[model samples]
Target: MSKKQHRGWGVGEQAEQHYLVEPRHLAGGGDVRHVSEFLRAAGWTDQSRTGGPLVFDSPARTVHVAYNPFVRPGGWTITGKANDHEPEWNVTFNPQTPVEIVAGFTDALTKSRSAHAPNPWAPLRQHGWETERAQHFTAVSPDRNAWLQFHQTGEGQAHWWAGARTEHGRTWDAVLTPSTPMHLIEAFSAALADPQPVMRPRGNIPPSRWIRTTSVSVRPSELGAWQQARISAARAATWARNSWASSSPRTHTPTPRPYAAAAGAVRTGR
Candidate 1:
């Protein structure tokens, strides 16, 4: 059966798949600037789509690019659709990293250790959170070396999604919309065989105002970091050239809302 093109979102000519990555899992410890540069170098053009194939046009070649970030408090979230319709998920350093990060961030945000214990769902659910019902939960577990997995392998509204420790100890998380940390215990428990992973309702999820942190530019000694970024980007370009021999059928269109917040607005999960 052919998957229908989503209302406003575009779809590619070929079948769809999923991909995942974590900036932290890379050689650099999740340096946002470096990651962005690497992806751009990897044949990922900033071009948007209207209603057809999802092809990433870059200097080297055109390919599909789907990426997710794991800077959230709970387990990571995958929230992107690529040209070939592949969902982007990411790898992690360990199996238990999701569970551990989610638990720690949740506690810090809700309990309020200090100003640094910023609320994850602040701007979205400013008033507060309402527990829908009592649910079973597992203990927090965070192993640095793990492969965070994600797939639409579910029936009806339920889906099959999971992340486990990889042999090389690489953990990847998907950065979905309204990016925030998740409670891995809750996420894993939410994934059961029967009904499928309960699909999160579509809505406006905003980030907390307090979560915005700071960053310092690389000093003269930090030039090494830039050098590595260039290398990674070059490698990415090479990967893109080999991945897509032919471009998919695509349509050009504009996206209504660029992201949760505007240019000057505070960006979540930075």
Candidate 2:
């Protein structure tokens, strides 16, 4: 049996070649002209059309864009095939897809056609972060002081937050929404590995106290130490519980004393 290969979102991977755009995430309407314009700008040439889906071919792959007016918001379904004998690719797009998303998808597709490189998020995955779903991930930092979360927004934009645990078991959160540059993502990851104190808004502030001008520079090492302390305390508590549970019952049992007769009763008997 052959292993099923995992492909990135908006990309289709088959035996022969990779299909770049999945229309469902890119197109906004049934009109293929807009999409065609995007393709033409990207160096694709219109091969042929016969009153049906418009066919376009590029050096990398061939594509078919079909209109479906009956679909809600009028959308397009795109199919791609590699020149070599390979599996076909199909994707559907609704009219609700924003133009920016379409543009971003096209840019990504263009890049994929030329050369393949490791995704920017590859490092996060290497360090223990697991993608919970599309554009969302959760991970614990190496220092264990902070729990980090990642979210990718529309137009290739991305954001992340680090939650630092404090001595009182409180969490201090810092959010970073860097520009959608690949280099910036790389720098952010590097910063996490060797965290330094940086001024950030206090995470513990409530809505009422939000006006308070109290900001602090938090360090990754501090958060790690707090996490370690919490672990140590937990271990101590477990040990104490187990020690008490394993001790002999007699050691804790109360002793009973015999009572002497009252002095008055003794005197009367004498």
Candidate 3:
């Protein structure tokens, strides 16, 4: 889809094959539930309980993810604290932010990485977004309601950070600090800027909100398929993370050089 918002209203294709993934918030609406589910499956420590914020910490305690209904009912708080003091990088998904979209960020986060740096702009450029500086490197979405800025304007602003934002009643935003991993942020950018049309019951697109939407319909079966695909993907990612963990190289401590001249010790045979 050339534009972020489509032209009309309709049901979304529920099947995995027919899916054109986009932020669920953009589609109709979304929640962090699925993201939390995936994180648990991927081995994150879950500290949340019934009717409270959704919270999880990366196994090493370096990263934290929170979906708070108390503080920011519509936002998600994610931070990386490798030093165990200050955050290396922080990405916050503002209220109304789609969990699925944010999942794109987490999806890339939990997986392994390559040697090259991430290019957050590739996806947007491919979608025909132009790049410029509004006091920072930024890209505007097709409908002009959203933005991707290289430097966030809030708390973690000084670091090598970037952000994604949206306006309107269902507005949402994201920010990353300088110390944040570039590769991970790249995944976030790609997810936000994806051009494929995602299925939405069409929130923010009807007459009241006045946003464009693609003409489409959803069948009951397809919806089931879509849900299935999402669950399957989550499980697969969990397995991949576990496999990676188990296969990671381990450091071996060499025995102290055989105690030289042990006092009154018999010479040991090799």
Task: Give a tens-digit lDDT track for model 2, residues 1-270.
Answer: 111222332233222211111111111122244345555544566664565444566545655544445545554455556445544544443443323223333323332222344354555557654444545676665444445467666776656654444334423333445332343334344333322221112332222211112222223443344335433433343344346644433121111110111111111100
The sequence of per-residue lDDT tens digits that candidate 3 reaches over residues 147-166 is: 67776566644634333333
Q: Give the distance in Å from residue 36's predicted Cα in candidate 1 to where it truly belongs.
A: 1.6
Find the candidate with the highest lDDT and give its number.
Answer: 3
Off by over 4 Å in 2: 1-34, 46-61, 70-73, 82-86, 110-130, 133-270
Overlapping backbone residue pairs in candidate 1 total 52
Ranking by TM-score: 3, 2, 1
Ranking the candidates on lDDT from highest down gives: 3, 2, 1
What does the lDDT come to for candidate 3?
0.58
Candidate 2, after superposition: displacement of residue 252 in Å? 78
In model 2, residue pairs whose N, Cα or C atoms come closer than 3 Å (at least 3 residues apart or on different chains), thus clashing, are 24-92, 24-93, 28-95, 145-223, 145-224
